[model samples]
Target: MIFVRLCLNTIVRRWNSTELTKVQMPAIMHLTRLGYTYAVKFHDNQAGEDYVPDTNILIKIFKEQFERLNPDKKDTFNQVLKDIKMELDNDDLGRSFYNRLVSVSPSRLIDFEHPNNNVFHCTAEFTCKRDEDEFRPDITLFVNGLPLTFIEVKKPNNNGGMLAESNRMNNQRFPNKKFRRFINITQLMIFSNNMEYDSEGGIIPIQGVFYCTGSKSKSSFNCFREENKGGEKVAPYNAEYSYKSIDSLVEKRVLTDFNC
Candidate 1:
């Protein structure tokens, strides 16, 4: 009887360690707590090569924010978006996009001064297509409707953990020209397996969360660490963030038995 119980517990533990359960859902939940509005779509198909901006959402948010920021400019929303899209198409590694994000262009894309004036959106399974290629990120974070960052989550204690994921992105994903627009628009990429760095390694990430500004270099992977001035470590969970329905949602969606 005890052996059967232990086996059941082991199965549950393994089941709970899935990428979606261990990291993706929790990340989305945390983002929602951090003031990001959850963006949901019934289908995974987001149209266009530069679906990073999800043109529809971009237009909606841009019009509202742009008109508010540049109140003197009348009916120039379309022109501004067109110019921004042109800049994005001609830019490299999202450099132009980043500029528009931080500073005011001929037109304003995001209100960096009043952060609350900008829209923060978070979504998962963000699928974007470019000709014959389709890249679906595990989680995509949007600022003012532009997908500036995305996260890739892996099952904990997987084959190579963080290193394997980094290699896959740099070797398989980045080199594909079909992903050129996607890569150009995305400013940051984060990877995690819900574990700490416990392996002996020089610079290669073996575990824990790491982020890089696009895949400019394979060696750009850097671990994320937060410490206060007092030398005490700070953690995300240490913050008091909660939602009334989050517990129930996690139980129903994250922890629920797929077999059942």
Candidate 2:
């Protein structure tokens, strides 16, 4: 009787073990496939043909632009920028962004991965199968294990080009349910025309986009939330604001919030 009981216990343990393996093995395999692609594209000795833009270059531009701005305009500009940034940093955005990039929690990911995991040597672009179609984002932001953000950048002089790109990005067909299932884990969707900044559903045109410059002045940042038609809110479609304000929003972890 004791032997029979022991055998039953062993079977139960094995069943539980199998269940756990079933859940974790697929993710491990999927991540491994992603890793393989990452390794091939980012080999150390690649030359000019393999180069990608340095994100730090963009950051440097923001810093330099801010420094170059006139001092009298800095205060108001800084305040508005700071407020918008704080709004973006709220918990919802941060968690969604972190989850999308890290695969696991950001803290644990950092603990297990190398410090430079999030920094890629080059931009790795690929087309993955989405439903029955193929879809690709212009750039994928990677850390060590997973993609953090999908960025679509447009040249500053590309008249109406940015808008076109934005439309493509927000298209449901691009991030089909399957792709969304894979990338929904990501944090933010960034659309920049090298001139304007915008995000999902805050205000349109006026409130939706901002001009990003580094100048320090109230004029550097403008809100499109003002009333235009007899106290009715006017939506400024493509007005520009300082890029500094946009950078502050990103740096301060404003886009971290997922809540609308």
Candidate 3:
């Protein structure tokens, strides 16, 4: 009788410890600690409860980073916007993503149709192909004359491996669409989540998707190739990339490389 009781007690203790470990786990995995200096520097003191990033700030960052990268690409901005619209029109998911992406920018204040205006309006639910269902994306990014990039964001807490899932959705929605047209015009695709990074640099990959993160050090930016032939150090398709601080990206003018 005593032996049976001891066995039962051991089983109960192990189960209790497992429950405690789970209780202590964070609600969200892969939480990133924002650099304190960057937080302080970018702090907004405005009075409204609806604090958001100003469109001018985005424009400034793009101009500074993009121009520094591709000084020759200035005339193509309008064309880039058109390509974005074309892609979004072709896919329902793209349309939805575009709507959310715009909300984060201050340029949302500008009416989309004024000629020479710096902001463009987009439809969240629009019919593109004849006899096809209406489509939507999470957000659409537009400038005065062109659709720039389509941003798709997922909250990690709501979905496991949300970044990978979002990328899958992007492929399904925009497959066979000419990324080159947009890439030629805007320079890159930004696929980011609240916690991870997945991007396609302007170049085509012979292997996996090319990725980059915001970094203070230029040397820290590196690319990874995906392969079925595995090695111990090889990361799975959904593995997280260490992100460079957003502050470093802004300060370094990395986007300016596209403008050249």
Candidate 4:
């Protein structure tokens, strides 16, 4: 747990699945502490109180980040915001949104290692509501106040696998408008459970959906059972596939941003 804390200092505290917090999410309060957009959370003209980004703050982050990457493209600001809003409302998976942001210039939109050249913002357990279907997830990772990833945590190996559900929820929900607007700029949709040991026969994978904690994932054993092997057979964890998806998006973001 300490390793997790060291690796990811998310704004929210440790989450309890059984005891879901009906109260306000901690991220809403600590966005500034965790380095939110411009080191400031959103506020409105009517009332000067900390709140999530409204349309203006969202557009401001886009403008500031865009200017940082492509200073020559100020003419595209209004149209870009219009396009971004349309993309956010229309595209459920945020593929188009990701492309629009990174395709403008060749610069890092999110850099943890670079203090000055960073636009990425990460928060957890923030409330996102669309029409009718209001579901609160465990975590939401953001870049420049634009969400980039949605992570759902469950008990150790709560179900059989996550690849199926991740696909279903993220890819197939386009037909249902109610669920589409909740996620924005999402490059990765991760479903992970705690480390679960196979009581009958031990398996190498006993942790989250990702194999490694810091931007790497690999599995030693295969998921399938070999006839010759005496012990229970295991197929390769699906982490490789997930990693490839994330990597492809990142690569595209870079190439498009650089105009290469």
Models ranked on lDDT: 1, 4, 2, 3
Q: What does the lDDT come to for candidate 1? A: 0.68
Return the candidate ranking by TM-score, descending: 1, 4, 2, 3
Tens-digit lDDT string for candidate 2 (67-126):
333234444434533432343334342444344234432123222344433333113233
Model 1 misplaced regions, further than 4 Å = 1-17, 42-57, 201-203, 216-219, 229-260
List, residue by residue over 81-193, the lDDT tens digit for candidate 1.
Answer: 66666665653766776677677756776777778888887777767565667778888888877777889887778788777888888887777766766776787888888
Which parts of model 3 are misplaced by more than 4 Å? Answer: 1-134, 158-163, 166-171, 176-187, 196-260
Better of 1 and 2 by TM-score: 1
TM-score of 2: 0.34
Q: State the number of backbone clashes in model 4.
A: 12
lDDT of 4 by residue, 1-260 (tens): 99888656442423332212321223222333344422222223422132223222245565677566556776776676566667866543556666665553433344445556656554444455554545555555556645666666555445554444443454444345554544444456555554433433444443445421111122122232234433434433422223211234433432343223
Would you list the C-alpha lDDT of every candidate in the order shown? 0.68, 0.36, 0.33, 0.45
Top model by lDDT, which number? Answer: 1
10 residues in a row with least lDDT, candidate 1: 48-57
